[model samples]
Target: MTSTGAPPDWTTVDIAVPRRSDRLPGISMAGFRQRVPSPVDITMVAHPAVTLLIDLGEGDGIVYDTPGRHERGSVVIGLMPGELRAGGRVGDCLQIRLEPDVAAAALGASPELSGTIASFSDVWGRDAARVEDRLRAAASWDERFTIAADILGRRLDARSPVDPEVAHVWRQTLTSRGRARVDSLAGEVGWSRKRLWSRFGSQLGTSPKRAARLVRFDHAAHLLAAGHAAARVAAESGYVDQSHLHREVKAFTGLTPSAVAVAPWLAIDDIAWPASSPTRNPGTDSPRHRARELGAGGCHERQTAVRDHC
Candidate 1:
């Protein structure tokens, strides 16, 4: 693996991604290693997928912080854990993002994990340590990715799948970038609106409307990261206006669009998760070109008031 430059103050971060043929449907994996080990901190941006963070380093691999809780080591981060921060002396780590449908089967309890973070052992039971040992002992990143895919593929095949209708709704919501109306989705699926809503929540751990908003916000965040102005991003992302965009961004990340533009978490996304669709807002540059324009670190102190998007 080659080194990718981080912000001015930090050492380079080496990123490893799976080969296209090795990638699994509904799952994305990337391995990260620090060139010069040191304490690191970053505020995580909200995304549509359920995240599995496998800590493979010794000592305090990673520490997570939410409003009133703190957790260390490998963890499962469910959809939209607002204002979450991950930091500490990370060495080598594997991050896997699971589509909600895949997560339902692979995790077996995704509905219970919504909007929260759980210990890896809590979700995988005694096998968590065993899995970590196997990953840590792997001869290379490619080996680790293969081992991870095998473990997840077996679990996914063993469990019941999500409702076809619910899965369809989710796919449509994302394709539309959160502009798909709930009633229209229900109609297309031939299910009553209430039925769709109930099933979606029970199976996906989040309502359809909330999922759409999250997806929409994620798209806008990437646009902002790519150097698009807030007004333009809002217009492209289906927001009522720039103010609407600001509120949603603040709600999800506790930061304004301008702040999110330089968020370190998003800087490595194009490198770590290369399969994401390129940002193609009209008249705007693609995110891949501006991905590393981000500043060093993330929001360390929690800000209470909303700031100007600027």
Candidate 2:
């Protein structure tokens, strides 16, 4: 993977995606094995999901800067995580993208994780090493996937789920690809605006408006990466104009729309999140198709004055 300026050459990367039956709701899994690797430094950009990377690497394979630095065997990347990267050497990693609702249960707490990056041990404690050991010891990538799925699935069942109303609002925001308005969602969900805001932030970790913007920006960023014009992306992704889109992009991630479109971090998204959407698959050609998958996670709705139409 190319970092420190030059874009990565995609041909050398080998990414393994799980079969449909192996998939878990609200989670995306991919086993990444990079060939012809080099020291890599690139922006992680901002996305709507909580990220968990289990280093299948022999040593510390990644380093995260800015947003509370920490390094270890595996890392937990909170929602809207800013720039970060894998180090100069290539290694194996089981990258899992957990939707906010699912993450609240699986990772222990959403408020504890939002906009932060830390070692998996910071949250999972010893379980981090135990799971990593099983993954590493497994004979095949598929077996590793199974191990991870079991752990996460167990956690999902173990912890209390988010409130039904809050979960509904989140699902609506995602289904609308961040275009859903807060007021509209609240009204639909029959909750007072203030109550909805309080519960959403407390349970999901980010305010409702912020979550939608992150999801919207994520959708737009992927579209831009797919070679769609910024103007076109803005119009279709629900922005008032290209400049509105530009501001949000720069706000969430320190990069302009053009740069984010070709971000090295997103270069491997297809292999990493193949089932992020229904039609998308690893190494696919359509950016538009992949963009759709970016917000494929679930949530419901309610209405409020705080809108994320930017």
Question: lDDT for model 1, on a 0 to 1 scale?
Answer: 0.77
Candidate 2 residue lDDT tens string, 1-310: 1122322433244567665667898887877665555665455666678888888877556666754575755788888656655455557778888889888888776788887787888888777778888998987777777788888888888889888899899999999999898999999989999999999999888999999998887777777755678999899889999999999988877768887665544545633553332233244434322222322212111111110111
Residue 14 in model 1: shift from native, Å? 0.4
Q: Which residue pairs in candidate 1 collide?
A: none
Model 2 TM-score on a 0 to 1 scale:
0.85
Model 1 C-alpha lDDT per residue in residues 25-54, reported as the tens digit of each score: 899988877767767666675689999999
